[model samples]
Target chain A: MNYGLRRVLPFFALILICGCAAKTMVVLVPDPDGKTGRISVSNQAGSVAIESPNQATTVSSGKPPTPPVAMEKETIAALFSEALSIQPKRPVHFILYFEKDTALTPDSLKQIADIIAAIRERASTDISVVGHTDSVGSREYNMNLSRNRAASVRDILVKQGVDANSITTTSHGKENPLVPTEDNVSEPRNRRVEVVVR
Target chain B: MKAITILVTVTILILGGSVACLAALDYVGIVKTIAGEVVIVRNAQTIKAEANTKLLKGDLVRTGPNGKVGLIFEDDTVVSMGSNSKIMIEQFLFQPAEKKLSFIARIFQGTASFLSGQLAKLAPNLVYIETPQATIGMRGTHLLVKVD
Candidate 1:
């Protein structure tokens, strides 16, 4: 009986410790557009406090906390590291333009090396290729052209050893233009494909 | 003498197993990228940060003037830090099968970006990033924050 009790005691202690353990997980993802953002915190129990170079506040239960506050680039990096215990990874973005009505261009071809290098740096990642077109063609025609452009880029990445399954391709056609223009207009910047590696 | 030696061996094995289990439960994320000068403060010791570095709860990460680093949590969340910044990870718990998740961290100074993953999609409020002056609640897919 003595030996049995000794063995059982450790298991019981383990169960108790596991049941009582409470941990907090924090995740800080950057804005894809690299713009200033805000964060808001409220205390559910005890007191949640925040202190920044510009201001400080303590939030108690049952009262409204401070309003959503915008942060600068340096401030965001510091706060994010503090909360997540890890540094955020820089996101890689690329824009490649298409020729008059096709999904190929000299400038876009030049960007292939940069895109491949970015994807190879990470062990595993997700790639987004969004195709766009100028307002020089009909909506249906533009949509098809944009999709073909995105597919063309995806093919190139896959050929360069990026996993095809990790790539997602979509088309915005003329709906979302980098440089908005009137109908039947040809904007060089608008007819492009944007790639994001995360 | 033989019996005494056997008993001592059994005791050591039991203790070692428990220690290993505890260490396994403490890991929350791993360093995916590091550039320039980055370091981590853990248990009062400062260690240089590098790729594939394992990060635990209660760890403080700081970067120098040219330092930059990236970290990915178990739940696929990504965080990248810029130079001249500091951050503290207070607590992290992710168990998707059981629907249990919570993340809390504080940024003392500097700039950082965050990309939400499974935890935020499963339950957004469970993840919290705090600054010296304000607390950030994520309502979107990506966020860039700076304290000073």
Candidate 2:
């Protein structure tokens, strides 16, 4: 028994060495019917066909194939190159302001309502509405005017079938300006609201 | 007076021409891998790549170096890399206005996992993965990418 075991040791060692030198190629594929399958091919001097439920397929060879590995590396490099091409642009800010007529007329109200409706339509989760005005009358008067403008638009939106709850309002009475002009000059454009959506 | 007018016209033309050329070369922006390096890349089922190659969206990237690659998508989703592995970013598109993002990656070598963000929550199909031979649609919270 000892003599037989010693004779078989060389054969087992040779098999282990050959297996370590073998290279395998695997391809992962999805099943059409949602079942897993695999097919394996060898780079050795032999070809073997396999059918498995898993879609993963592996081809093993008795010796490692330098050419195929080199090719795979090239393919992966191309993919990396392609993924690096798409990028994002810098954010741009565009400001829009509303004007206050000498007195609120039907046309003016309609325009205000239209602007509010547009803002409501475009209001995303991060929407903000800030009302402002030109330095006119008194500080209190300007503040009231700004608040009223914001509230007025909010009211119009509610009447136009918008969710008033989603809208937030703030007043910046004469703090910001579209154009720097003298007081009481009726800077109509400054009596307005700014809407931002992110 | 005529010579002065001609000189002014020539200067305007030169300035305008240069401005136009520079504008043409202006970069909109580039989406690229913030942390990963491409150890292996090929083309159309072929092997071999040109030197100094650049990667773009939809390109598959397999990295080895203890899988230390990292990537940050436009939507702020972060992906950590693995060692002796392959990860392919299948698709990535970030449009903040519509809150739309598309992202996909595949792994072929070692192990990899992903964390979801705007791309995953907004558009589920945007993220995908592949293993030794399987294309995995990312639906689970987290996954392990490995090839046995």
Every model's TM-score on chain B: 0.85, 0.55
DockQ of each: 0.12, 0.02
Strongest candidate by DockQ = 1
lDDT of 1: 0.69
Say which candidate scores most in TM-score.
Answer: 1
The stretch of ten residues in a row with the least summed lDDT in candidate 1 chain A is: A17-26
- Assess the local accuracy of residue A110 in candidate 1 as a C-alpha lDDT between 0 and 100: 88
Question: How do the residues B8-95 of candidate 1 rate in per-residue lDDT, one tens digit apiece?
Answer: 9999999999999776766777778778899999989999988867789899999898888888776667877778978898878875
lDDT of the candidates, in the order given: 0.69, 0.46
Model 1 interface root-mean-square deviation: 10.0
The C-alpha stretches of model 1 lying farther than 4 A from their native spots are A1-121, A124-198, B1-24
How big is the positional error of residue A131 in model 2, measured in Å on the Cα after superposition? 18
lDDT of 2 by residue, B46-133 (tens): 3222221334454555654532454434443545444555666656665533455666566555544343445556566556554433
Candidate 2 to native Cα RMSD, angstroms: 19.2
